[model samples]
Target: MNRKNKIPKFIFYMIALWTIFSTAHAEEIMPKAFVYTEVQNSVPFDQIPWKSRNPIISSQPGFISKTWLSGSGNNSVGGIYSFDSIENAKKYVTKFFPNAVKKQGVAHTSRIFDAVIVEKASRDIGSAHFGGKISTKPGAFVYTEIQVNLPFKNVPWQQRNPIIKKIPGLLSKTWLSGVNNTVGGFYAFDTLENAKQFAIEVFPKTAAKMNAALYTRIFDARLVEHASRGMDSPFFQ
Candidate 1:
């Protein structure tokens, strides 16, 4: 082939490869958005470093939302952290909970889920007063890995939305199913007691009715940042 012809072909190939790479990694690492979560049993509030809140965090920079979740068990703690960049998320975790990634024991399970969808609230539930940093007391992040028998597309959306709209203290919900038949979701609640109630009272009858296996965990969690999607997305309000 001539030099001119070869150059055009090379440019085409380069563009193709870049497109593929970008699409593949788009959801895995959102445009400066990531979710970090950890779940353990009965993590004491004193151990977490980021305590006491100042309203300035939301005003100072990029997205920031933080809260403690409540699950059915009092002995469990699961923390959820999100940030504008992967570097920021990692730095916060390393600086405060340096040992957060390690396995403390059989009972303690710590995790960080960076691949999550940030959704917006459906109702007029949010205000500037309610916004900003509210991680006053350190608590656990609750995570339940749900695998329903039905495909995500086939799940009952009409029934699910009504229940989600009523729950309070639920900061964020992540719908984590890709092109697979089985789907997953990660929820960041403001309090463990509310999380526990939802898990026990709501999830069973609606979301996990046909699930073959259900996994639940908790951790000592701190809210590093909290930025979520807009009201356009379809989820519990």
Candidate 2:
């Protein structure tokens, strides 16, 4: 081949290889998918046999980690889970998880989020799974989601950080941005009372100000530590 032609061909091959390498690297470091689920008015955490259920959960496709949640004031039980991909997370929540919880005879709520998109914002607030494992003193958790008409980019997550940090007993938080402008977070606090207070009184007022529908739940983080640790939960570590 001519020298000129050979040089151009080599450059093209190098560019192609560089592109492939960059794409692969991005995938490797991409944030994981997350799933949250809760059963209202269900059995107590101790009665759920969550520890024994770890084996089955661990064997699921793309399962990464899980944090078991027990309602603070009511008999609700739930979990926050991480998965390798959004497809797998959605499948687990819609296809696999529901059937497993049907025996409770109570309605459960589930939602999926693209963890990659909110990694920066979440980490700024000490999200454990996102390398911001600052406050490990969590004994309770508060989960909240508010439906809004705006897009995820307009959600003001950073602006709210200062206010959230001031809330009594707060430990860490992982922000969630879901489909159709539904945004929320999974939070950790020092006590169930504090978590419940935030979920019920503080956050709801914010939601009301936005005129958005809100979903909130408070959980006993201490009770489910064993079950969460068994599933390699980041919060436990």
Candidate 3:
């Protein structure tokens, strides 16, 4: 289809904006963004400017780790935030996020969810892990927000992993699906072009074959910081 969502020309501007600072321990995985219905007591706060002026979000209760996207248009705003537990994750969205927006003064609307990490992989293009060395440079990734048919079934990881392993330039893929059945994945690529190419070439056929109702968004993602116990290369369809 030759689809394109170009990163802003002001490249460095995005590098400055997409930043995530977090800490994690092994054996910790929690829910996805569960749209918080209640306003988390905004109670008077500071206003944060746009990207390039991201407020330093420190580690706190429920805060485990996160992945952020920079840029506009093709750029995304929210991120994958892991918490101590599903309850803790929900609390953060209902409590922390409202206040965060108030103090940061950033316009954001969150659809909270509690998702489980069904699979994680490091495409073999490079060592893609949950946690790794920190870097601020802009990187590219695409994650899908989808709904799958009941009795979800697809090609076994044993078979799919081999296929993805052969594709060139995939950094990593973290599969997450909400309890409500929202399915998607977090992926990192060497370039935005590569990410889009992957979205068009691989996802369509695979998802249809699996009967998964899916859609994808490519973004300028960054891995500011993380803590991992080991590497997971399971390819989830």
Candidate topping TM-score:
2
Over 1-237, each residue of candidate 1 has an lDDT whose tens digit, in order, gives 599899999999999999999875443223233333444455444443333322322232333444344333353444343455555655555543445435455333323333322232211222111122233332334456555444545655446555665676565445433223444455546666766666667666644556456655443333222211121111111
* TM-score rank order: 2, 3, 1
Candidate 2 runs further than 4 Å off? 1-30
Off by over 4 Å in 1: 1-36, 39-41, 47-74, 85-142, 148-159, 166-195, 216-237
Worst 10 residues of 3 by lDDT: 228-237
- The stretch of ten residues in a row with the least summed lDDT in candidate 2 is 23-32
> What local distance difference test score does each model get?
0.43, 0.82, 0.47
Model 2 compared with the native: what TM-score?
0.83
Model 3 lDDT, residue 85, Cα: 65
lDDT score for candidate 1 against the true structure: 0.43
Error of model 3, residue 82, in angstroms? 1.7
Residue 61 C-alpha lDDT in model 2: 89
Q: Which scores higher on lDDT, 1 or 2?
A: 2
Which residue pairs in candidate 2 have backbone atoms (N, alpha carbon, C) closer than 3 angstroms, thus clashing?
Answer: none
Q: Tens digit of lDDT per residue, candidate 3, span 47-136? A: 212233233432446554454444324233555455546676666666777776677554565544443334333222222333432232
Question: Candidate 1, which ten residues in sequence have the lowest lDDT sum?
Answer: 227-236
Would you give me the overall lDDT of model 3? 0.47
